[model samples]
Target: MDIDFIRGARLDDHLTIKTYISEFKKASLTFAQEIVDQEGVTIAKALVKVACIDNVKMKPRPFLRLS
Candidate 1:
């Protein structure tokens, strides 16, 4: 999984966080998220990607087919 932040967020400020799943598959998922202040200003943004992997084989995990 990888995460990147575009800006800094402060703890003292009231913030609203929203997230969306941009892509989804059996083996991986991609998401986009943002943090905004009460004034509707964007405080931070992030992109996340999660992938399924097999630790023992050190390779990507295969997706199961549904009937």
Candidate 2:
């Protein structure tokens, strides 16, 4: 899936947001670990939009998460 993000922006997508948010959290954890390995705790924020592709039979909306 592809993603786009901006600060303080509202998202319209509805479906697949939960799973996408989980995956995004994992990825972010990895990144944070990379940084924390060298330094102490660091503050960071993230905004992500993931594409949710659904078949023609079902309607799907994209997913967005901010953390």
Specify the highest-lDDT model's number: 1
| Candidate 1 similarity to native, TM-score | 0.71
Residue 33 local lDDT, model 1 = 88
Whole-model alpha-carbon lDDT for candidate 1:
0.79
Q: Please provide, for model 1 over 1-67, each residue's C-alpha lDDT reduced to its tens digit, 9 standing for 90 to 100.
A: 4445556667688889899998888788888888788888887777788888998987888656689
Candidate 2: where is the Cα deviation over 4 Å? 1-37, 55-67
Kindly list the per-residue Cα lDDT of model 2 for residues 1-67, writing each as its tens digit: 2333322222542222222243443223211111111123322233344445455845544444568
Q: 4, model 2: CA deviation in Å?
A: 14
What is the Cα-based lDDT of residue 33 in candidate 2? 17
lDDT of 1 at 29: 81
Against the true structure, whose TM-score is highest?
1
